[model samples]
Target chain A: MQIIFQIIFSLFAIAALGLVWRRRADGLLSKHSALWWSIIWLAVLALAWYPNSTQVLADILGIGRGVDLVTYCALAFLFFTIFRLTIKIESLQRDITKVVRRDALEKNNI
Target chain B: MIMILVPAHNEAKTIENVVKQLLFVGDKVVVIDDGSTDDTALLAGNAGATVLRHTLNRGQGAALETGHTYARQSNADFVVHFDADGQFDFRDIPRALASMKEKNVDIILGSRFLGKEQKIPWLKRAVILPFARNIDRLFGSVSLSDAHNGFRVMNQRALNFIQLTQDRMAHATEIPQLIRRYNLRYAELPISVSYHEFGQGPIGGFRIVRDLLVGKFM
Candidate 1:
């Protein structure tokens, strides 16, 4: 189980690093965002490698199990991503409204 | 001159009729066809309305803002925000416009509750009305009997001052707050609303509340 978990962790870390690099090269991700994502992936790799450390952190946090602590962290990350995406979508909607409004006015010469 | 601005989305069936009615009542009519998949734009244009087409479906509030921007640029004396659902009575316009002039107010908002002719569903009256009224009382500055009536007439000054950011139904609440924010004089006119073909279900009522809360926080 430990060996399989390590292999999975290593694969995910490599994939995340590769993704960050590709996104940065494509100019889709800024250098700052790439760096931050890479750091998060590295931390994920470290946590996966030493699951016992999660238990120590869990003990400090008064959580019942290391798995519960990891679950909470994963849920928090998911929520943060969702929140960021929602904000981005709303900003895009506003921009689209401006563009569409301009186009509508121009089309009708109003 | 009173210029009627109608915001329509997938209201192809009633677009032409609404435009015609408004044109008969007002000087000019402009319909904002908010990315309708149907023939709303073509019908409205054919009905003697200047059709402004939004490339995307933003929302009713966004469409109204677009129409208002155009109306402002055109220097219209008064701009009437009318729904494309054909619920509002054209006869009420004279009274609304008259009240606006007589009272020296910049805006005349139409209220269904002010009249006995309005046929409000029991569910909406019991659940949606009280909740919407409470929300408006909490956040809105100008207190009115009705908070979500879409029929309103605003002069150029009021239009220039009330900037609506909410692209959805939340604009109904946002407009009154903006009225208070800008210290624009406003009055409520008794208007009738027919719910015969009003398709908004119970879920839509809840969605409005959810959108208002989300808009408040975000």
Candidate 2:
């Protein structure tokens, strides 16, 4: 339990440090997809706590109570991915509006 | 009036020199200090350039968008994107402006590869150049080289048409697609590149490959 706590604590602590030093750490998230980045960090967190959370996650996954850790992680990742896609869709809407408006204005001038 | 836009992040060490060089060209300079923790904005302001700040570090595309918005609001004729890393040449600014006058091209791209003695990194030359050309070919684009070259001169019409939203290093890739989509007249002029300075090394080719694949599918 203590080791699990330490692992989770340390992993987040490192990511926190990374967030703090992100400006200096160019190309860390710049290279990878934000989805994969989120998945990676979350997976690390799950791996750290799996020994404790497995039984609960297993019940949730429809398997033995010990295998739900991966399931829960995947479900959580899927949710986060949907959220990311929603943001992208919103941004694309704004961009599309801008394009439409500007194209109209340009056409009027000619 | 000319408005020079220098999109910067954590470029305190080189911002002042770039600002001074831009001022030497007798053009009004605007430095987009994209949430640099360092004194990039302060030093740029002290060096006599108007500095704008983004509270959070957005990508280069965002910085360029900020500059474009500001320049358009201020009724700027030509908005030139010069690098804050001191890799660009100011002498070519007049030539770009003149090219706009002569050829009626809306966007002027500075090409490091087109010059007689180009100094682009080998990885960029070998991998990225071909990738860019291929991407252009796939889009049925002709008459543009090194679309991802950060250094560029964009006019008011081009700015309105080319909405840069990639907001990161991908903005370089975004410009060509926008140009093609909007049917904007874009031309490339040779510019010198010297990537041999301190802290310059080739990034992983696989990392670039990953970005390419992700951008393509996404």
Candidate 3:
């Protein structure tokens, strides 16, 4: 069961890495974003191959289990990402408003 | 030139009458149809109003900002921010404008709590308004009798200086904040508002607060 889970996770990471590379090649993603995603997927592959590797780091962090440490880190990262996205979306909304307002004014000639 | 700016969204039922009535009070009536699916823009135009249409449904604040820009470009001497739902009395327009000059103020806000008795809902009068007033005071740095009155008359100074970026109901609070920040002379006049089934309720009040907080941080 453990080996099967490891194989599935590793395959998923490899597929994600492939998609990221394709996106980078198609000029859909910046080099910085491609590198970041590549690093993340590589870390996922490493953890899937050696699940116990996290235990050493978890012990240093005073966490009882490697999975629990990973869960906490994942949640924190998700929250931070959400916060950054929210700020970006708000700025984008403001920019869209400026364009819409200018268009409305011009169309009416008012 | 006085320009009555009405920011409307899906208020087709009341917009025509609102625009016609407002025309009597101002030199020109401008109705901003905020991406309404109905015939708001058409009716407002037919009723002798300059109609501005937002292609997307931006909030009332965005609509009003567009109206303000129009008013500025057309060289309006005074701008009245009136609601399209017909809750506000058109007769108060003269009084609000007069109060601006008499009090030597840049802006005059309509307050339902003052002077004449209004048919404000008890929940809004007792609870929502008091809480909103405190929130406005905290952020706006000014104590106003009515924190979120839609009926306001602003002179050229305010028309040029007060730019609303909230793009929603939070613009109500943002107006007061600008008044304080810019040291603009503002006065509150006793005006009546008719409560209808369509206006903002308690839930809407919470959304305004949320928008206000998010706008402050983001």
Which candidate's DockQ is highest?
A: 3
Please identify which of the two predictions, 2 or 3, would achieve the higher DockQ against the true structure.
Answer: 3
lDDT by residue for model 2 (A10-93), tens? 679568546634733665555345444655666566656555566665676677656455666679979978867766764674
Tell me the docking grade of candidate 1: medium
Pairwise DockQ winner, candidates 1 and 2:
1
Candidates arranged by lDDT, highest first: 3, 1, 2
The candidate 3 chain A region of ten consecutive residues with least summed lDDT is A82-91
- Which should have the higher TM-score, number 2 or number 3? 3
Alpha carbon lDDT at B9, candidate 2? 90
In terms of lDDT, the best-performing candidate is 3
Q: List the residue pairs that clash in candidate 1.
A: none
State how far residue B61 of model 1 sits from its true place (Å).
1.1
Q: Which ten residues in a row have the lowest lDDT in candidate 3 chain B?
A: B192-201
Q: What's the CA error at residue B197 for candidate 1, in Å?
A: 2.0
Error of 2 at B172 (Å): 1.1
- Per-prediction interface RMSD in Å: 1.8, 10.0, 1.3
Give the winner by TM-score: 1 or 3: 3
True contacts kept of 2: 0.00
For candidate 3, give the lDDT of residue B18.
Answer: 91
lDDT for B135 in candidate 1 is: 74
